[model samples]
Target: MVTATADFVVPDELLAHEPPEARGVPRDAVRMLVSTPSAQRHQLFRDLPTVLRPGDLLVVNTSATLPAAVPTLDGHVIHFSTCRADGTWLVEPRLAGRAGAPTVGPLDTAVAGQRFALRGGGSVTLLSPYSQGRLWVAALSFDDVPGYLSRHGSPIRYSYVPRSWPLSAYQTVFATEPGSAEMPSAGRPFTDRIVTRLVSAGVQVAPIVLHTGVASAEGHERPYPEWFSVPASTARAVASAQRVIAVGTTVVRALETTGGAAGSGWTDLVVTPERGVRVVDGLLTGFHEPHASHLDLLAAVAGPGLVSTSYAAALAAGYRWHEFGDVNLLLSEHDVREV
Candidate 1:
């Protein structure tokens, strides 16, 4: 309903179809554009570990990408989350069709716990089903969303990242959450080694879960609406840490959600300038397009000109867009001057 378009237009060549041949030496090895409430600075992604000090806590979304969308036979698409799978899973089912009168639908050709029987003997199964047809609230499990996607499903895909990639490639080095369709791409370059180094360097690390649906692009230009929750430990870490650096927009939303006046709930909180930000001190994220709701959240916290200027720099410098590309790291002016 809140349909809109990005203010800036990305050149066809700027879109990244895949990551570098190998994950970079430092997951954060890519170039980083540093923005703050005060001024602008340019740096590399690897410089991130050093940019912030020991007391600065890095908050990462441990939410895993969920491979919940699968095609059905009768035109009824079954969308579900994979909980567990030994070739079987509890899945949330959705009849992705006209939200009205149903003709035969895809039910006739749909099988609950078995593969749809592709052209060959190959098959995919919606192993588990929810209490009803509620995909969002369903407690569905599958052998493995990751495993199945490797075999049949695509990267909890969307038009943004524009190409099918192995699920492993889609994940961030610190990925532990198994419910995101797409990896928190901003964190994609943060490989295990980088994370280890950050830990050794005294940068505190904490996890929050946010099961991201697909990319925000598919949701009619709406803000990324994800299922997120902060653990007590994470909550505590955030409250006590001298600095909180969100790994990506998703983590930002999750962390900010917990800090809100209402506290926490099943948040469909679409962060915007009006809603404003509370907990995040700095952010490491992909360069979102102009007018993106995520950008609004950025503006809410980082200021409109700040994000806009940083984005312009990112674009001018030929920084890649989407997951599988370079990154932008923003620190608060208050911290920038201190460092």
Candidate 2:
């Protein structure tokens, strides 16, 4: 197993409190830190088309965000993580604050068969422990999960964001399938204009589907297995591309799991510096927490040295952090040739 330690401290000020659109900044106008083997450069996200070669393939996730957080009568919030093949769900229960923000709740005291009443006339019974007791295997009383969520659920909110935002704010232009618990945030910055420019510049863009689960705010927790699908056309595009640039860690996980093949299933593959990567040549992702596991994937693609240097630059430049923050484009020197 590959593990990562927290290498630096992220100041509280760097956290983005709201989306750029709320602050009068266009989504595509957000700052971008471009890191290559030779140098690091500061640019706007709108300049993405100029940063890549014509034949470079940009792989993006097409999973849309779901309003997965439902409030319980006991003042706890249930975050629906993922659905199992057997039809049960993996969920995390968090304490709801007075202002409606959520914090990590006690999972140790939760017992199997314990049931919590939902606000909208349903209940969830805890079936077993999942992910080493960090989450629970839950069986919802409602038969239509999506329909129930649409009527009673809101987008999951953490303490950083003081108020709730609409579901539209959590979606990307490429979203076609609805299943992800959270947004594939790296693609959040891409607008119709930028995609048009990229296509006009001959940068091929393809879609992969990866339904992301709820993010673990705890320390050093490895990512759980999530659902993904790589279509035949995307696989072919990846195999023949001059370079494959993944738009997020989710895309990297999907592509690396399939190794440029067309397939669909759950992926538990975690990209680490030791394991490295085979299908991805570059990555465009949002800034992560100092100790986030996503950093390991970035290091695997671009090397630890480049990842460290680029992060330091981003910190020094006062770049924002989190889903609604600035972005980093890491162009790796070690392409598929090394594989």
Candidate 3:
């Protein structure tokens, strides 16, 4: 039987606990590890413009990170994952044990019909179970969720993060729409200066929207359906570009779900080795956890052999992991050679 790349072991020490800004570095100062079929190259994230050619079109996700974690009076936190068409949301309730402790774990409480009083004025009523466990379909009492979150919610964080960060620290420079439960972190290394340099080098940057859901996953679980949109202009640029470089796995999913055409919908597409990619030529993403389903998408684009080598190289170099971590650029063998 073939093994999945998701079974790899990532060292806990490599998990980045703070943003670069906290470490006294600029947004684009993170390390970038470029991977190809034949070789790997270590470079700074600021070197992106010099690395790619003029005709390469970079596709980015514009969905902003939401301050989706609402604390309750009882010490439990409610995470707003995704908002459904009916105005209700899919949420997960977690017990925040204490400071410097795990914030989310197995939730054993029954939520149906239970009303949670948030720190803010409004309340959340649990409607029903959205899945097997941990998640529920719930309604918000407030009329405007965005405005409420701005005033009361904090960025969703786990134990690894140790402390909370402002929502502005979670947002990318390209973020324009507010929806993602987590940051589109691949774009975290980008800055206005970096973008200007890329444009000066003739690299075209385009936006696609993929309102990402929660990042926490059950062991070996496949990706859940998330809303995505590929506009006509982005589709055209992707079709005409010499190379279509996706900024994250979200971009890969959105572009591939439409088969490079213009469309919008919820997609449960899993880009595995068996179900190889069709549109994206390369990917720029952060280092993910070992055994993460995201690794399957990387394998589908760069092949499992190269993915393994790249992971090994990244670990050997003590590269950081998580949303505020280092980045990986997966391009073709020829593209790497050209750089």
Candidate that would win on lDDT? 2
- Output the better candidate (1/3) by TM-score: 3
The C-alpha local distance difference test score for the whole of candidate 2 amounts to: 0.86
Give per-residue CA lDDT, model 1, range 1-339, as digits (tens).
121324777885776656764544445667778887666677777666677788888888776655445555534444444333232333333344443222222233334455443321333455333332332222223434456554544454434444445657777766775777657777777767788888887899888777765443322343324567687877787777888888888887887777822233345676676776788887888877655567766776676777777877777888888777778887765566332
lDDT of 2 by residue, 1-339 (tens): 222324677788888889999999999999998887777889999988888768999999999999999888887778888987788898987777785565555455677898999987999999988766568889988888778888898887777787789998999999999899899999999999999999998999999999999987666676677999999999999988999999999999999999989999999998989999999999999988767888888989988888888888888998998888999999965332110
Worst 10 residues of 1 by lDDT: 100-109
TM-score: model 3 vs. ground truth: 0.94
lDDT of 3 by residue, 70-113 (tens): 88887788888887777788888888768545476646585699
| Ranking 2 against 3 by TM-score, winner | 2
lDDT of each: 0.62, 0.86, 0.85
- Runs in model 1 deviating more than 4 A are 1-6, 22-26, 68-151, 158-163, 218-225, 260-265, 334-339
All models, RMSD in angstroms: 7.5, 3.1, 2.0
Best by TM-score: 2
Clashes of each: 25, 0, 1
Candidate 3 structure lDDT? 0.85
Residues forming the 10-long window of minimal summed lDDT in candidate 3: 1-10
